[model samples]
Target: MTIWLHSEVGHNQDAKKEVKAFNSEDVFTTPKPERLLERILILATNPGDLVLDSFLGSGTTAAVAHKMGRRWIGIELGEHCHTHCIPRLRKVIDGEDPGGITKAVGWKGGGGFRYYRLGPSLIVKDEWGNPIINPEFNAAMLAEAMCKLEGFRYAPSEDIYWIHGKSTETDFIYVTTQFMSKQMLARLSDEVGSERSLLICCSAFRCDPSQFPNLTIKKIPKAVLQKCEWGHDDYSLEVKNLPAAPPTLEQEEPDDRPANSRRKSGKGKPRQASLFDMGGDQ
Candidate 1:
């Protein structure tokens, strides 16, 4: 038996034409050919396989993947994501778009996808180098995040405010902002019993470790200090304006400090910033 291999399925002009048809104007300067993506999809994946496009320029990959009966995720940081890609995908879902590889794949679409924006950062650092949870997080969100960080299941107990979560029936975790005194620690240790162990995470603790063998005490802020960025809330990928530099050499040397002293003090000329920006969860 013999098999003949065929390649070069799509032309660049076809891609341009498809974009013009869908967008009513050729907005994308370099749109990808749907037929090219279709060929790649056919070669590399089976139906229902997952496809991910990190830079979904014109939504060609996602559209092709959707038409091919594959689940797909596409991420784009630019405003065109909302202006172009989303509308095009919505049209594809409603079976209104007849361009691209739709006819070739026999696509009369009936699929849906939900859109979501990245929320605030979970943790951030304060000026004092202490880790603080984001104010945007509610009690439930905080508990969930703590459970994930500590490798415990999020199962808050209704009867016990101290029991925020657990790793096992005999091993439990508690999260709080209040300081735990030695008397309070003793009471919790007694409640946990000999067979069980308890881990308490709080702002501060006045108990001695030797007194409670079964109770593990951890101080917050210090414990999670190096875990993540403490106070940064926004994770959006947007360009930022920077401070302008002094125009002339005299303006640069406004102060009476010597040039060598300025250099030693780490006050050099302004450095060029990075062009590419990225954020949010991947």
Candidate 2:
């Protein structure tokens, strides 16, 4: 014997009812019903399989996936990610949301999920074609991103700012936006010693490669300019029909400096890198 599943397992009204129970009002213009996701997951996946919802509107897919014993990932680009999805997921984890396929699926929730935000764009191009790091990035964030871009592990030294990361025990990477003179590079080469190598990324370096075979110098914005698209910053989908709003004080004249340089010039200590093992190509 064979069993056939109905294509229409849920209705829009059911989705509205589910959202209204938790949101107190119909905030979401359109939310997916948990039953629909349940049917789809049942057909396409098994317990412990991974499910991904890229545009997580009200997080119906994730909620259903969690209840169905599936590992899941959800991504939302708007503020609704925090305002709507997170609260809803919290309630789902605590078993407080009882309306959306909870009884049908025997979902008395007892699991949790983690939340993360994407960092600022790695590099942005100015009109002059110079590669400037995104103003939103901090020292640590920039260091970590550079490590990934250059094929190294982010491992900062507690006593050294230049030793931001390493590819091997003897090979390291240092990221800085300051101008580096030949004398400075020579000192760094001496510190690195003959056995190890150091890759220095700086805004300007007045030196020759022949002087220090163990030290490789790369100029910023120039070195990473051709790597990625630097013009298009916001990747989120926006409703084009909405009326344009006037810019606020903060938005009217945005600060283009890196996050750490908003106040005084070079105010605090630079951020030290941390250790993480991930693979990528330069």
Candidate 3:
């Protein structure tokens, strides 16, 4: 075992001086010396190893890790994440910061970092104690969230108004807060055509769902709620683990044979009908 003294690993005063080099106006309170982090990382990790600091108060661990050629993730819940961490990390990445283990590690910074802001919870309770989508979400955000909930890739089409997401090249999803009428459904069905399938998530709809063979209509909050389980003791499985939606049906030219007659493909094999094609002749 090697004894580490302030002379080698540095102390609290040294930490303050390091931070003052970049941000002297707002010095961080509880910062660990970069040399201290360097010693710990050198013993516990190697170059390119991932280091995680959940309580990143002054971003010292991440800064030292980056200089030492180690990958790092720093999580700070306080406002200092924006004030101190980001500013300090920026200097380190640009090779502008020359304090702490910089000279010792020969760190001429050449790396980058990405910052992500997590969104608020999707489900929130109303005054009536009913679960509803958080009103904080706008139209595009709500559509993207719905796409994630339904396991579809969130890629809205510029030309098509209803194409908010897609599970495949032929299967698509649409999300709306508007109440869907039968006439609107007819218009959507004509637009989607018989060649492809669409899943509609709306606030409300009037019409027998069976009327549209190519569309699967589900109400918004209800569909989202069904995908989430409440007050369950066993946490074994998640609702997101549910099976994927069925594939789109292959449309054929108007068949002259009876509806019940077996349709043969060009390869001389019987073609299987999708369960979603119930309204179409099987």
Root-mean-square deviation of candidate 3? 11.5
Q: Which candidate, 1 or 2, has the higher TM-score?
A: 2
Q: What is the Cα-based lDDT of residue 18 in candidate 2?
A: 81
- What's the TM-score of every candidate structure? 0.53, 0.64, 0.67
Q: How would the candidate models be sorted by lDDT, starting from the highest? A: 3, 2, 1
Tell me the tens digit of each residue's lDDT in model 2 across 1-282.
Answer: 143233456777788878777676547888878888998899899997768899999889988998998867799998878777888888888899998789988989777776768876677767896567777878788777777666667889999768988764566789888899989998888887776778787888886766887777877666676544455768554535422332333454544544322321111212222111111111
Evaluated against the true structure, the overall lDDT of model 1 is 0.70
Per-residue CA lDDT of model 3 for 58-152, tens digit only, reads 89999999999887778889998888898899999889898999999998877777775668877789999987778999989999888877767
Model 1 stretches with alpha carbons more than 4 Å out: 1-8, 20-22, 128-130, 135-282
Candidate 3 deviant stretches above 4 angstroms: 148-155, 166-171, 179-187, 194-199, 203-282
Query: How do the residues 63-182 of candidate 1 rate in per-residue lDDT, one tens digit apiece?
Result: 899899887779898887877788888888889889988998899977777675655676666788655766787777776666655656678999988888776455677887778998
Q: In model 1, which residue pairs have backbone atoms overlapping below 3 Å?
A: 123-229, 123-230, 124-229, 124-230, 124-231, 125-230, 125-231
Please rank every candidate by TM-score, starting with the best. 3, 2, 1
Better of 1 and 3 by TM-score: 3
